[model samples]
Target: MIAIIDYGAGNLFSVKNALTYLGLPYQITNDLEEIRRADSYILPGVGAFPFAMKMLRQTNLIEEIKKQVVEKPLLGICLGMQMLFEESYEFERCSGLSLIPGKVDRWDAGGLKIPHMGWNQLSVKQPENPLLKGLQEGDSVYFVHSYMAYPKPEHLAAFCEYGVQVPALVSKGNVYGAQFHPEKSGEVGLQILRNFGGLTK
Candidate 1:
C-alpha cells in the first residue's frame, strides 16, 4: 500500500480518489508509524513551497521520508515534485527535500504565459526508466504551474515543450517525481498511476 502523506497542504482527496478509481490500496496519513509501515509513499501538493514545507515540517515527516525513500519508491506530484529538489524559488529561496540534484525556479517561457496550463506532449528522454513503462514520446499530460525544476539530465525521464523544455517526469534510484497531476490527466494519467502502482512491493 502507498501512504498518501497528509501534510495539510496536499490535494489529498483528489489523489485518494484517483488511487481508489484504480483500485490501488492507499491510506492518507500524517502518522509517522503508519508511514514507516507502508510499502511506498505519494507526496501530493497544491500550494506554495514555503507554506507546504512548513506544514510538512510541522507533521514531523521530513526525516522519516528522507530515511524511507532510500529503500522504497516515492512519487511526488506537481508542487510535491518541486519539493523533491534541493531548493526552490517559488516565493523565496527555500530548501527542499534534496532527493534530486536540482532547483525549482520560475519558468522563462520565452514570452509565453506564466502558468503553462492545459495539455502538453511529453518527450521521452530516458526510455528505459521503469516509471515511464508504457509511456512514449508525445504522450500528453496536464500541467498547471508557474515554476519548474531543472533536474540533472540523467534524472530527467521525460519533458514537454511549452516554449521551453519543461521537466514532465523524473526519476533517480527509488525516487520519482511528476510535474503534472496524473489524477487530472485522463487515461494517460491512469496509465501513469498504474505504472507507479506496479513499482510498490
Candidate 2:
C-alpha cells in the first residue's frame, strides 16, 4: 500500500483519484505513525516551497520523511519534487529535505513564458533509469511550474527544454521526483504513476 502525505500544501484528490484508477491501495494522512508504516509514500504539492515545508514541519513529518526516504520508495510531484532537494531559491532561499543535492530556481525565461505550461517532450538523460522504464525520449508530459530543480546531472533522470534545461524527472537511491503533475497528464502520466506504485519497499 502507498501513503499520500497530507501537508495542506495542495489538494491531493487528483493524485488519489489517479492511484484509485490504477487500483492501488493508498491512504491519505498526516499521521506520522501511518507514514512510518506505509509501504511507499507520495508527496504531492501545488504551492510555494517554504509554506509547504512549514506545513510539513508543523505536522512533525520532516524528520519522518527524511528518515523514510532512505529505506522506502518516495515520489514527490510538482512542488513536492522541489522539496526533495537541498534547498530552494523559490522566494527567500529556504532549506529543503536535502534528500538530493540541488536547489530550485525560477526559469531564465529567455523571452518565453514564466510557467512552462502544457505538454513538453522529455529528453532522457539516464535511459537506464528504472523510474523511466517504458518511457522514451519523445514521450510528452504535462508541466505547470515557474521553478525547476538544478540537481546534480548524475541525479537527473530526464529533462525537457523550455528556454532552459528543466529537470523533468530525478532520482537518487530510493527517492524520486517528477516536476510535472503525473496525475494530470494523460496515458504517459498513468504509466509514470503505475511505475511508482509498483515500487517495492
Best candidate, lDDT-wise?
A: 1
lDDT of candidate 1 over 110-155, digit per residue (tens)? 9998788999999999988877788767989999999999999999
Displacement of residue 87 (Cα, Å) in model 2 is 1.0
Q: How high a TM-score does candidate 2 get?
A: 0.97
| Residue-by-residue lDDT tens digits, candidate 2, 1-201 | 799999899659999999999999999999978998999999998878999989888988888888887889999999999999999987788999999999998768689998889999999999887778888788999999989899998999999989978899999999999999899888889989998977955
lDDT of each: 0.92, 0.90
TM-score of each: 0.98, 0.97
Q: Worst 10-residue stretch by lDDT in candidate 1?
A: 128-137
- In candidate 2 the C-alpha lDDT for residue 162 amounts to 90
